[model samples]
Target: MNHELSLDLVQSSVLAGVLLILGEFARRRVGFLQRFSIPGPVIGGFLFALLLLVLRQADVATVEFDTTLQEPAMIAFFTTVGLTGSLSLVRKGGRLLIVYLLACWTLAVVQNLVGIGLAEVLGVNPLLGIMAGAVSLEGGHGAAAAFGPTAEAMGAEGATAVAVASATFGLVAGSVLGGPLAGWLMKRGKVRVPTLVTASTGSTTTVVDQGSDTGSDSGSDTGRGPETENAEESGSAGYRKLLSTGVLVGVIMVLGTLLGTWFSDTTGFVLPGYVGAMVVAVVFRNLNDRFGWVRLDSGTVDLISGLTLGFFLTMAMMSLKIWELYALALPLVVILAVQVLVLVVFVAFVVFRLLGGNYDAATMAAGMMGHGLGGTPNAMANMDAFNSRFGVRSERAFLVVPLAGAVLIDLVGLPWIVWCMNWVG
Candidate 1:
């Protein structure tokens, strides 16, 4: 079984390249994925997983599950997440953003509780279930990778295997839950799609005109309607000032990590380098917003996110052992089933009411369902599905959901999990 090439590295690199090419191709040529309820990443990942299995069975390719690649990708993804963590977005979203973030945080907590309970009942280590269901499933691959090492340190066997299994199941469940929940909410509320019209005059009108057909209308007649857009534009500026700000923040984070490492060495207190990076980013974003020094570019944030996530998914998929998952099949199925039920009921009743029982509510719920179960892509897919049938309010969903999935909730989830671990421990 010895091979010259590093099997995991080679396989993941190859898979990422293939996914990028196929993703672009499918996005351009086969619009069915965009038209239909399926998510592009989900489709890509599923096809890749199936292909890997087929190749393995045929003895055409061999893959060794390498856990090492997971950390760098995870750190890169989280750093991207942090770079977008401007308080401006939160301020712009206002009460609605707060509600959504709180809802997601609550869901993460509930997910962990459900996992722990299930594991205790099934006589497996509760930490294993917690890692699989909450950390991996709700938090996606980044959290899975972050927690995998922690799980091992805490005495959970096959922590990486559990993380992989949970991430796979999360992808499937997240994609499935979002569209149906949004559809159901729309049906229950009798929400009607608004007539979209664009004025041909004025800069504001021109911007509106361009985005109107795509249903990105936000009711504000301003050139830039929301905080997210502003932050994105601010962040995207490639000027010396913006680049300097980003670099300064990056340096601060690096310095913080070094300080933490030294402190840990001296006082037996451990700090993750990514955590230091995130803290620095958060602080800088807040300071920038307060002082009007520089803005965060949405395009840059999105670009970093896409590249980091692509690499992260590649690492995750290449490290999967299909055979190992077979052993945990029964519990995995049960956990997924419970998660699906929980999401459906939560979105239908609780989330809708909190969101004011409107079309936007339905769309937002769909996005949350996608994120809570899968990740940001799934959330976007759900919104896309809702938009295709009944014109989407793109700004509302796009601004809110991405902020929730990409930054706020992700940062918040880590500390909450640590708190839970302490309480349980």
Candidate 2:
């Protein structure tokens, strides 16, 4: 075989390409996967992993870890995630955001502690357990790659291998545990779904129609109302203003990061560049809302989030080493089982109660399942499932869960993982 077209390289690349295409198709076409819940990227990644594993076991394909490709892809994904800190959404989320952050932080602490304890009992270095548990499982692949190297340098022999195993198990366990918890909660709580008509009726009645009398006076005026005309104009103008504000916000975030870095150096207090940018964005968003500087742009926020996650997932999936996972199977399974149990109990009792317990126990359960296990995508999937059968008030769940998963948990988890490493190592 020619060097460039060697069987191993060509086969691996082709397999990855095929999986990506098929994953996208499955995401669009498969209703059950989308609705009842499983992250599309994870589903795709796992299937690819399985295929590679089969090939390797059969002696048909070989994979060599290229540290070069792994690090850059992982870093790029993390940087993109950093860039997605939308000021407007952070402002809008408000106290709920704070709550979500706290929850994430708390969960990270619990997860790491559990891992360390388990590691001690199992007789491996607790650092190995921590890396394989929360850092990989909750934080996903990028984190696994980040800390896996550190773990190896510190003498955990199979750090990356353990991290991958933990992450794969986390993805699976998170998906499985979230839905059933949601279902059980809904059944137990007997929460009734609120009607959209009923919720809107009260708000709608408060707006007095000045054209009500005019409609009665002439049939010609019956087809349209002043309120409707004003609404259409306002909606268009609001959207335009939101777009303008979003662009300005992005610019401000960049500038703020530069300023923050300067201040950090002079004042001896340094913030992570991305964290500084997020804080600035949050301030800008709140200022815009408070003084009416700009209307919030929902579309732009959605677009940024979607693009960031897509690229991140793509990079993450490509870097996975399915072959490395075969070495650490026993401990990975134990860690995953414990983590799942913790998530199920915590979400069912604690998260649901904290979120005001008004939602169908099922929907809340699904949200917890997603956030606690897999992250926001998993939670969204669970909510989609509940929405299909129970109706879609799950929006509240969606809003809160992602807020917790993306920003809050990461900020909190990094420190906890570091602490665990210190204590255990």
The digit string of per-residue lDDT tens for model 1 on 92-116 reads 8977788888888888888888888
lDDT of 2 by residue, 152-211 (tens): 777777676677567656666677776677767767877667675544344434666756
In model 2, the worst 10-residue window by lDDT is 1-10
Please state the error at residue 143 of candidate 1 in Å.
Answer: 2.8
Which residue pairs show collisions in model 1?
232-297, 232-298, 234-295, 234-296, 235-295, 235-296, 235-297, 236-297
lDDT of each: 0.68, 0.62
The runs of at least 3 residues in candidate 1 whose Cα sits more than 4 Å from the true structure, single-residue gaps closed, are: 1-70, 189-253, 259-271, 292-298, 392-395, 421-425
Which residue ranges in model 2 land beyond 4 Å of their true spot?
1-19, 29-49, 65-70, 86-91, 190-192, 195-323, 360-362, 422-425
